[model samples]
Structures are given as C-alpha cells and as structure tokens.
Target: MTLDGHCAAEFAGVQAAFEAEFAAGNEVGASLCVMVGDDVVVDLWGGVADEATRRPWVRDTVATTYSVTKTMTALAILVLADRGRLDVDQPVARYWPEFGRAGKDEVTIAQVLDHTSGVSGWQQPMTVDDLYRQPDAAAALADQVPWWTPGDGSGYHALTFGTILAEVIARVTGTTLGAFLESEIAGPLGADYRVGMRGGLDRIAPMVPPPPAHVDLASLPADVEPRRTLGNPVFSAAITADPTFLAAELGAVNGQGNARSVARLQSIVTGRGRAGGRAFLSAETVDRIVETRTDGVDRVLGVPVRFGLGWALSSPAMPGVPDGDVCWWTGLGGAVVSCDLGRGITVAYVMNAMAPGLIGAPRPNRYLAAVYESL
Candidate 1:
C-alpha cells in the first residue's frame, strides 16, 4: 500500500488512516483531498486504478462519483440563483411549463433541491438505457404525479433528482446541465470534473461494484417508497464502467471526478459561494444551502437525515464531520464530501472499491475521523 501525494504535518493522522484502509484491504485505488480556505492541505492517491490492468491511481485519475455529483448539480443551480437568473423559491414549473402538469405545478425549486419534491423516482417503468436519453426522460417526469405530497417531507429522489433539476436548468439557461457546469463552473475553475464522460478515458479508474443490495424488491409491496424509488429502473453500480452510461449526462449519479476536483468545486460553498476571488454564490444563496429543509426519517433512505437546499445538513450518518454549519453528501460506494462553512474546511474522498449500502462506508469514516482528530 504505497500512498502517494502530500499531507500537511498537522494532518498526518489523515494520511495514516488512508494507508490503513489499503493495509486492511478495504481499498483498491482511492484519493483523499482536504482544502482549508483556498489552500489544499492534503492530497493523496494510491492503489490500483484498474484491477484488470493493474494500473496505478495517478494524481489526475477520476472516477464516477455517484451521488457526489449532486453537489455539483446543486452548485450550478445556486450559481444561476446567485446571478439572479433563477430563483430557488419559485416553482420549478415557472421555468418549464410542462413540468406543471400532474399536480407538480406547485413544486418549488427549493423543494426539488431538498429532495422533498415528491417526484422521487420515475412513475413510468424505465430501463437503465432510458436514463441516458435526457430529453425523453425529463419529459416523462414532467408528466407524472408526485409519489407523495410535495414539501410534506423528503423521499430521497435517487436518480430523478438530476432529471428534475437539469430540466429546470435547461429551461432557464438554454443549456444542458453538463454544458452549464463545464462552461460556468468546472471550466472557469479548471477543475477536472464533468457530469458525463468525454475525453481522458485513459485517466478513468473503473469502479468495482459492491455486493448486491439486500432489499428484496420482489417481496416488498408495489407502492413502497424504497421499491418505488430504487426498483423502477433498478440501480447497477457497474454503469460506472459502461461507456454509453458514462457518456450520458446523468447529473445525479454519473459525475466523474477525483477527490481533488470534487473539493475544488464544493469548496465554493465553504467559501460562502466564492472561490478564487470569484463569486459563484451570494451569501444569501449560501445561507439557503445550509437552511434546514427537512429533518426527519427520509422516506426512501429509511433513516433520519437533515436536508438543506441541495445537500444534507450535518447528521450522525457522517460521524467524521465536526459540528457547525455544514452541508454534505456521499456517493454510492464510499465517496463522500463535506463542506464546513464555519470551520473553513472541505474534505473529499473518492475510491474504486465500494463498500455496501447506498451511502456511508467504513473507509471514508476512518479517514474523516482522523482528519478532525488531527485538526
């Protein structure tokens, strides 16, 4: 387990915790990056990027970051709001008229951001391939009824989150979510991240799918929240390796980047919507990012979660994160990122090997715990 990159002396425990994962065989290839203010205090990568080829996980390696992509999607929308091009409080249907159909006309963009839109998953039966076709998929969602009462509570949207927000973004900006992110966010910041895979195939670290989920959708009742949200198209983590899936802009799930790139983008929130002297979000928008939208047991995830605008507020699920005004999210497998506005700390971790469950794994827990302890 030869760890690479740099870690500040004050954060040596974080480095040790990362090395211990590989030593314990809990990691394949991974990268962990920590940023304080504008400075990167810790950056590290090691292990095999591809198990089949025995390729090393280099400094520039990027992998499919699952739900971590949500943070980026959220930021893009916040940018629009910051610049007065979009309003989070306005109904999503205000931008996309068709989205108003089927009782969703009242669904606010803030509700969509907070996972309380009640359009948690597609009502129509869809194949995984349907996820790749953005326009058709977005329209399908626009025409459906909410799974639950909008804004009553949150049911993790899972995949539909991207579709819903992307449609709104497209309606407002006349650009795809990927294009808006690239031109307005990633391109300007020089962050090596994208919603879809294009170019740099050689640098990708293929993810190893985790064990199959224990939920027996077949046994569950048809209208159950988990079955409805997770079973429609069903999730297959192997999509990270599929070129066609990688090429499509599935803003909720298919974000491709390493820890460093994820931190670079998410840190804007930690900086109160400004980074590198650029104002990506206004102070008011940043406040919205941490404002508690829902704080209770999530209908789909089946756990107590505190959701803010587009990310989760601090919760016990992420034990490594310190208490304060913080917003964060995790990817399938083990990828996790947390932005602490009060402490001026942002930590991101990405990996090839996956642990069980949709969110939170032992690997990131260990590293993040070490990070705060060292601090």
Candidate 2:
C-alpha cells in the first residue's frame, strides 16, 4: 500500500495480517512510518478512525503518542546539554531551588531522567485542575517527599514525570517545554508534532478503548508491580480525558503527533544527534544520554528494565531491531518509536486504540519483526 507518494510494501504478509486484525475487531485506526536515514521508505495506515462515524484513518490524522513523548522531552534536555546550558550530573536543585526540599539536594538531573528520583506519584489525591495549572502541580511536587530514597531504585513516575522535568527545564531555560520544542526542534525540521495541541481539536483522533478485559491480578504473582501500576485508578484517570490536564509543557506524557514527527525527532538518536543537515545535539551528548544507569527490576514497574537518561535502553525486556544500538519507548496503548543507531533507522507506530499495558501489543512486535527482516 502506498499513500502520498510514499511506497510501502506490506512485507511478505503484513497487509493480510493487518486486515485480519481489523476483521477480528482488534485495531481501530493506526499509522506506521519507517525512516532509513532521511527517507521514509514505508508509510502505511488503515482501519477506521471512529467506529460509529465509520471515518477512515487518513495520512494526516494525529493522536496523543503517550509516553513516546518522553523521547521528545529527553531530546530537549539533550539539546540543552549540547549547548552547555545544562549539566545532567548537576543537582536538579541547581536549576529549581524549591526541588531541594526534602533532602533532594543530591538528586542529579540524570537520576530524574532515569526514573530513579523516587517522586513517582502525588502524595495526596489530585484533581485534573491541579495538573492543568503548572504552578500548583509543581508546587505540590516540590513540597512532597519521595516514596523511597532518590536513586535507590526505579519507579515508573506514571504522571508526575512531566511536571518534575518540565519545571526544571522552565526554570533553567525560562521557557516552557512545548514552546522550546516548537521553536528549536519541530519548526526547524518541519515536523508535524506538537507538545501542546493548538485549537484544532476536531481533527485529532480519540483513543479507542482497550480490548475486552481479561486476566485477573489475583490469579498472578503477588510481586507483579507492572500489573498493579497498570490497574491503578490514579494512573488510568490521569491519562483518560481529564479536563484540567494541559497538554503543553507536560513533557513526560501527552505528546500529540503522528508517526512522521516521532521518527523525525528521534532520528537524532539514531543519527548521533544530527538529522537532515541539522545538529540537534553533539555526538558526545547523545552518548551520555544512552549510557546505562540501571538494568534490573524496577520498583514501580516490577520488571527488568534497562534505563538510560529518560529513555529505555534496548534489552531483552524491551526488544528492538536485532543487534542495533537502539533505545525506545511506547505510548500508553501500542504507539511505539525506536531509534536504531546501528542501522540508522527510526520506526514509529501511532494508533487510536489504547492497549491494556505500558509495554506494546503483539501487533507491534510482529510489525517490528517484519521491519528488521526487511533490513
């Protein structure tokens, strides 16, 4: 299937497999894009945007890419590092003084980026209004204590990551994450990605509901933190249409874009911080971001994860194209973005459907296998 002068062969059997999933009512609307160097060798989409309206998913449609937004936030930080404006090893309090409260003076920027800062969730129940208003949210976080000692272990930081990191960025740069991203990254590359959505809500595709629920947690092992994190009402409610939740400046999550923008931004990671004749970060800075911090069971996620600065390192738990210097992350549902440095490949998949877990669905794994095979 080819659309908009982008040629995409559905691999040996991807088209039939995609059709079968749609026929079985598994996927709603989705888009996948692959970039080798600067060329988009494959760009494909199918299925319906809305079940009731029966509107087909078109090439230009975009949706919230979930945690994949973390990659973008990470890139912004890397850009600062490249320009000698920020230091990853410096105490986060050096930029945001209020964060120094509660014995956080020693917490480095790298610790927060690696999910080891221990400020995983709000201490008290928070309303959507709390999130939309950055000052209130950031103040509350500044006042709260960590769930554990900072840099002791990893917790997913489900909703609080953006607020924490964004506050640091704002304090240091005197600009919101969204504004900086548009002026520095997206605008220069001509990528159609936005941290904060503009006034065009009608054009975006709403996320499809999860598949029919299955597998009660009581039947599983007691130590499964991933299941607990996924099932938490606080975590789910934070993401599912909260009125006060502002999209802009929320760096850890709530990124709105399609596959094209994701691949374009992440190409920096694959290309050693240079893409399309632009240098977003220095090669040394990119290497620093990818340096491994912890490779073990995460205290919050309760799974073996190898984390780099604000990105998941390629490991058995988070597989990528074979034998590549790859780092990646997925949105809440199945949306995925990975930068394969060894192969100079950037792959992105965004969809309207929200899956059940933080990891990806079987469909994405199949797609990835096909992608690797093609190479």
Q: Judge candidate 2 at residue 48 and give its lDDT.
A: 69
1-375: candidate 1 lDDT, tens digit per residue: 778899999999999998888898889999999999989999999999999899999999999998999989999998998788988899998998999999999999999899999999988899888988888999999889998899999999899899889988988999999999999999988899999877888888888988876767778898998888888887566667778877889889999999999999999999998887787888888988888889999999888889999999888877776667999999988899999999999999999999888766888878878888987
**Model 1: colliding residue pairs:** none
CA displacement after TM-score superposition, residue 348 of candidate 1 (Å):
0.2
In order of appearance, the predictions have TM-scores of 0.98, 0.89
Predictions in order: lDDT: 0.89, 0.74
Q: Which prediction has the highest TM-score against the true structure?
A: 1
Model 1 regions more than 4 Å off: none
RMSD (Cα, Å) for all candidates, in order, is 1.0, 3.2
Per-residue lDDT over 1-375 for candidate 2, one digit per residue giving the tens place of the 0 to 100 score: 222325456353444445566677677887777888988876767776665577777877777787888888888887887788888899889988898898778888888889898777676557655667777888887777777788887888766777777887899789898998889998999988888885555546777767644666556664444444333323442243332342555676778888888888888888898998999888887776568887888876667888878788776655543544678888777788888887888888888877776674676776777677765
RMSD of 1: 1.0
